[model samples]
Target: MKARAGGPDHRPPLISEHDRDAAVHRLQEAYAEGRLSHEELDESLHQVLTAKTHSDLASFPEENESTIAAVSGRIRRRGVWRVPRILKVESALGRVHLDLSRAVIEHPVVDIEVHLGTGNARITVPRDAIVDVEDLRTGWKDPLYKTRRRSRPGGPMIRISGTMGLGRLKIRHARR
Candidate 1:
């Protein structure tokens, strides 16, 4: 057991991956129950994901949500745009391209929920951003995401979920 920073205890309880996961699940439940705002959830998620020990986890951010949908036209978002805490994107037949390399993302954690019918979706994340696509579901092809052996510490976490029907998801990290 390692002592937490600034704590009085000489030997603190050891933290495990299961513990971290439980914390994250509880935070999500809190958000779903309206006890926490989107921003608050983001901040809390970041802390939970990045915390080295249990004592370091605390605080949360505000609330904001955004959506992008298209029936047949291409859905594209690039340049210096603001990213909301919860972003919902839906497209029936158009390809979706989201470039977050140069976007303004204030939250520590961003959830991108995508629903596609036909065309593929491409997402370019920031160089140091941590991306998780475990919850993403595909109808045909698997997502084209090469996981890095190790990511930099304290990068904002991005979670991509939802369904991609008859289309694939391609994720790449920014070059710069």
Candidate 2:
């Protein structure tokens, strides 16, 4: 059925009795067609009746946010598969170690924004990539600096921005 735009009818119910009835009907049809065993049908019907919301009905029993985070972190660590892509790294405390050696890209660029309450930070880039350092600090030493090197042609662009607190940011090209 088509729903009118910006209307209450367009909004889906968080939990609807009609949806529960439909699920029961489907279970009955499956049992009649011998597609679902008696035990399986009973278990499915119990689940459908016990699920109070659409989210509860749609999700697996073991699914959760931590599982998703672990999967995402593993994928992100595979840097070689992420060349020529923009990466954002943030840490409230502790140092962030990034391995530029494994990052295989013609020009691997990074744009970093750091907000450190304390401690130090270091960002390493491949030797073939160009490093651009920008520090916005009111304190001395700047707590961030890039080693002086002749600008090489066709190098990746690396931009780093540092915020408040004491921390040293070292940028160097990764050795092959």
Candidate 3:
């Protein structure tokens, strides 16, 4: 289903005990890897448990047309590049929306990082790609986000880092 700006896309917040467990497991892994300090992990864990709606859990940027336009343009240009053997996405706070409907990439892998303070997130991946997901939290639902990985060719790898706020991320793939 297409998500309109400011329109209620009722896809039933994809939350479940399994989802929660996966998120927590990822956080613990980060701690073990020393990617996150103990203090940071504790704070994120608390926020995740207390969060209710998607907005209560993910991070989003202010809706600025110019900013969106600029970022969109950058993404478009970069997307046109010879698909890197690997790609990476990293963010600290605010929502990230990616539309790959018109994207052309010959790359074999992509990595994403999302950082949050308190909020919810939704991410959509192509319908034919292989994906692996991981999350690191600070409080409650540490990384309060929902992820969908569709099957597609090209074998892309994505890694997301989330912080505080509510938002979504989508990746569309070109048809062969």
Q: What is the per-residue lDDT of model 3 for residues 1-176, given as tens digits with 9 covering 90 to 100?
A: 78876678645464666655656676666555434446757866665556664444422122111112222212323233232223343333444445433345333444444443323334444445554445533344433333434454544454544333433333344353
Error of 1 at 72 (Å): 0.7
Off by over 4 Å in 1: 1-62
lDDT per residue for candidate 1 within 40-80, as digits (tens), equals 78888988888777797654434578899999989999999
- In candidate 2, how many Å is residue 26 off? 50
Best by lDDT: 1
The Cα error of candidate 3 at residue 17, in Å, is 56
Candidate 3: where is the Cα deviation over 4 Å? 1-93, 135-153, 162-176
**Best first by lDDT, ranked:** 1, 2, 3
Q: Give the TM-score of each candidate.
A: 0.66, 0.45, 0.34
User: Which one is best on TM-score?
Assistant: 1
Winner by TM-score between candidate 3 and candidate 2: 2
* lDDT of the candidates, in the order given: 0.86, 0.54, 0.44
Ranking by TM-score: 1, 2, 3
Tens digit per residue, CA lDDT, model 2, 1-176:
77787776765446799888887887777556434546767788888889787755522122111111121122123356344333445444455555565665532344545455444556567666666665445232454455647656766566655563545555566655
Quote model 2's TM-score: 0.45
